[model samples]
Target: MKAKLITLAVVVVALGGGIALASASSEPGSGPPAIGVVRAVRSGTDIVLPFDAYRHTPAEINVIERATAVLARDCLNRFGLHWAPPTVDAVDTSRPTAAGRYGIVDAAEVARLGYHAAEPPDRPSQPQPPLDVLMVYTGKGASDVGGQPVPEGGCLGEARRRLEEGLPAAMPGERFAELDRELYLTAQADERVQRAMTGWRECMAESGLRYADVWAANDDVRWSAPEPTPEEIATAKADLACRTRSGLAGTWLAVETAYQQRVISERRKEFDALATALHARLAHARQIVNR
Candidate 1:
């Protein structure tokens, strides 16, 4: 529960550049039109349609670009108005402006389904609030990797440091120990925390590790015995479980290879799936239009 959510939050923030900070002014007029879903009948009452296709993929991005182009051109053609694409820094998909809201149609698909077609759906006179578009590239590939070269606030190393310092304390009585044993430690060890651990390790390797430093910390390689007692093994397992649940596993095992590889692989797949789906939806429109 707590552990998993924290880990997930970290992963998302790492990949997506942190929880998006709300700006004082993300006015739609100054930003990209935020798209929302609309349920409407296209042709006969027989054909019900959802005008917004929520696909986030390369193909979907293309659809967005094409649709925007068509809409912009149409608005110009019909209403004698032109709109500039919003700048990247101003894109705030989480919160869109109302006045700048644009109604994005799947165009050809909407027309084929019997929705009244606007040769260009981008009409300033349509009375529909202006809408800026958001095209997201999603899937496994978009997951975060700590070692990848990023600007200062992005390294896994920094994340690890913060994790060690402590996250906002969990609700009272919900110590890392209790959370790990009760909710986070997957029965199979292959389920949740283990995978996160793998991701952290990969981040370390990518960032480069110092064996001397690691050995110095352990002291066992140079001064103590290599084998751990049964009690030590049990302690280690418990510790790992505790760390995983707390989202501290990545910071703890920042040196392990197996863990990091798994994390990276998982994120890649997530992004890939998102991209694939977006492409499919866009292709759907193309099929109808070409027909």
Candidate 2:
């Protein structure tokens, strides 16, 4: 039996929102401005950027989850209810998924997976807390379970507050996430990047695939098959070829990196301060989990 890969479907949703950035290069292949290190063409599975430093690693995310469980458990204990950790959406503003950010740069990956995220096995389902416990946890019903008072928004909200205490005015997030979200939009709107996409589209058309853009090609309903289809594989291969041939990958990366440099330089102090606060919060979370 062949092993199946999970698609996660998050790639398209993450790439949907974008806005134009200030004008730059006539040449899409121009190198990013000399502000920070520019990375080589990378696989969709290997995307790492300057702002990634601020994003939580898998381990760090684990620590955060554990600490939240502990704190929520403390609140639930007051009401004589047990709290099993539920997987909450990312409270920390980590950078969004980067899989389709540049519109499919990895040929081998697309050929094998076809615009799907190369994620691990499906996660085990989290244990659900009882309805009474949830009412207190989410603050949806009564203020208190039995007699113990529930914190504002219940335990989850309290845990979030505890985690975010002492951070800057920006609650729950920092500047890096804000900039990362904007950078992609900016790059997408760039003239050079747009020209490169035109080239990519033309290449796809020649291969008998009609797509308005890279995302359109990736979102074609046919790829929604339970597994990669012959057509999907062929189209993915052509997409990769077209990206390289049209300079889409190079141009987008350059434009995005340049924007990152300008923003990081301009907000170095604020970014640095936010980073320090984040590390400090993680340290506290570590202590909570250690207990």
Among these predictions, the greatest TM-score belongs to 2
lDDT top scorer: 2
Find the 10 residues in a row with the least total lDDT in model 1. 1-10
Candidate 1 local lDDT, 7-34, one digit each (tens): 2111011112122222212322322222
Error of 2 at 152 (Å): 1.1
lDDT of 2 by residue, 91-180 (tens): 322333554566566666676877665544445566677898888778888875676778998987787677666644321242344446
Q: Which residue ranges in model 2 land beyond 4 Å of their true spot?
A: 1-40, 84-97, 168-178
Q: How many residue pairs clash in each candidate?
A: 31, 1
lDDT score at residue 242, model 1, on the 0-100 scale: 31
